[model samples]
Target: MQTIKNLVKDNMRQYGMFIALLLIMLLFQILTSGILLKPLNLTNLILQNSYILVLAIGMIIVIITGHIDLSVGSIAAFVGAVSAIMIVNMHLPPFLAVILSLIIGALIGAWQGFWIAYMRIPAFIVTLAGMLLFRGLTMVVLKGQSIAPFPTSFQKISSGFIPDIFGTESIHLTTIIIGIILSFLLTFLEVRKRNQQTKNGLEVINNGLFFAKLIAMVTVILIFSYVLASYEGIPNILILLLALIIFYTFIMKKTVIGRHIYAVGGNEKAATLSGVKSKRVTFWVFVNMGVLSALSGLIFAARLNAATPKAGNLFELDAIAASFIGGASAYGGIGTVPGAIIGGLVMGVMNNGMSLLGLGIDWQQAIKGLVLLLAVGFDIYNKNKSS
Candidate 1:
């Protein structure tokens, strides 16, 4: 019993927000009389918050490096406008337009990274200027209007679902099969990881606790798959998100560049003295942000089936809030990709739940603000307590 308590205490920071997320979902599920977890609403929740989740992925990395990009919202808008012109106005192929838009996003990131990293400018000032600059550019490109009726092919980026290969009408067999495969894969990976830890003389959690965690994870995945399969099967956006999460989580956990990022964030001067290229790391981080921001813009525009001048408004705030709530510390050098993704879901669920309850947008905003504040406060409290 004491060992179990010790384990929980040790992992509180890592698992706390995840537990909170589950609790929130459960509360909403009960309050909405089981409406919150319905297949259709669940699908809508994923589609609606896809862009914010994308932004949170990038934003968490930025925060990990002790920087913030205020201009992501404007950047997304600018990219969307550019893509709209290419696809809707000039009749360019959607694939080509997407590729070009991503390149443009990378260039924008490099521009900001150059100023903040090489030129020694503060990120806040640079991104603030960029926010205004790109917003104006978006307006100028759209001529203060909106572009509509994007090509069907482009629209599928957000609205499309993976087709059922089994051709079953009642349930999506492919989705369930995929979920089963994922469950086995996850179990294998966890067991192997535990074995490796033991082999390397690292501390391993109690066997019972570890197995319990594995069961919980597999159950969640299977249940999620069943829900989605019962509706329209898995969404293309969810696949993209899963891919991004897996790739980023690997990069942050296992790669040399990932370690460099954390080192630079933890202490730039110390990292520089130890042969880490702090400036280069910072520059590339922003460049990565730019690409993701652009991708987010594309997704948002595709979902709307139009590019509006006001598109992507306040996106930066949502992404930042998601990052912090997911456990990215304001002081830098502490965060995880999964944490950010979970944070985004928390916000998404809240928005969906409140909308179902007929709450006004004003109240939603206030509640979100309070949640963000509390999340940051919790981080600070943990830091002070550790000290």
Candidate 2:
């Protein structure tokens, strides 16, 4: 029993943010008279937060590299403008326009990378300059007008739902089935990982604690899935998010490039000496950030069905706040993809909840600022204690 308690305690530190998210959601659920988690609102929440999540994912990588990109929001706007010009003005196919937009984003990233990684300019200065540059360009491209009523196909990118395989008129059978499968797969993976660790003579969580975790995770997955199924079913944006999460999580946890990234962030001189290709890692990180920013722009434009110069205003703040709140160390060398996701969700929920309560935008911004400060303070406290 004591061993299980110890296991739980240890895991709690690692999962503290997730716990906070659940508690926050629960509080809002009750305060909002259960409107917070209603199927339709839940769906809206996912859609509303999807672009921020994409940016957060990319921002986490940049932060982990001991660097920051101040221009993601601007880049998103620029990319969205380019997309609008391509699809709406030039009459390009939506798919082709998306491809061109992504390419442009990669090019923009590479341009920044050359300056920051190759020329050795400070990332802060480089990205700050980029923010202004891109913002101006977005304005020029948009020409002080918003382009709207995108092609139906492009709009569907963000607004579409997955086809129900079971074709049920009521509950989405496919979503429920997917939920069950995911639950089992998650449990199996956890158990397998623990077993492998044990085989390698590494410490493992107590069996009781492990089982409890499995149950909790499975329950959450099932419940969330049910909620989606009860609505219009799983969204296309959610699927994109899941794919990115899984892909990045694997890259960070299992790949050589991932290790090099952390090593570079931890100590650039040492990583270089160890043949970690610090410059290359830094360059690629920015490139990845660029691509993500572009993707977010596409998603945002699709959702709004418009390309506005103001499309991605202050988005960098949301992404940066999310990354930091999710456990990314300001000084780098510490963070997780999952942490970033939770952090973004925390911000999203706060915004949604505040709006629901009739709180003004001024209060929302102030509250978010305070939350960001507190989160960074907690991180610093932890770092100090550990050191």
* Top-TM-score candidate index: 1
lDDT of model number 1: 0.96
List model 2 lDDT by residue over 227-313, tens digit each.
999999999999999999999999998999999888988899999999888999999999999999999999999999999999899
* Residue 121's lDDT in candidate 1: 99
Quote the lDDT for 276 in model 2. Answer: 89
Candidate whose lDDT is highest: 1
What overall lDDT goes with each candidate model?
0.96, 0.93
What is the Å distance of residue 44 in model 2 from its true position? 0.4
Query: Candidate 1, TM-score vs. the true structure?
Result: 0.99
Clashes (N, CA, C under 3 Å) per candidate: 0, 0
Alpha-carbon runs more than 4 Å astray in model 2:
1-9
Give the per-residue lDDT digits (tens) of candidate 1, residues 198-278.
Answer: 999988889898999999999999999999999999999999999999999999999999999999889999999999999
Candidate 1 stretches with Cα past 4 Å from truth are none
Task: Provide the TM-score for each candidate, comma-separated.
Answer: 0.99, 0.98
Q: Give the TM-score of candidate 2.
A: 0.98
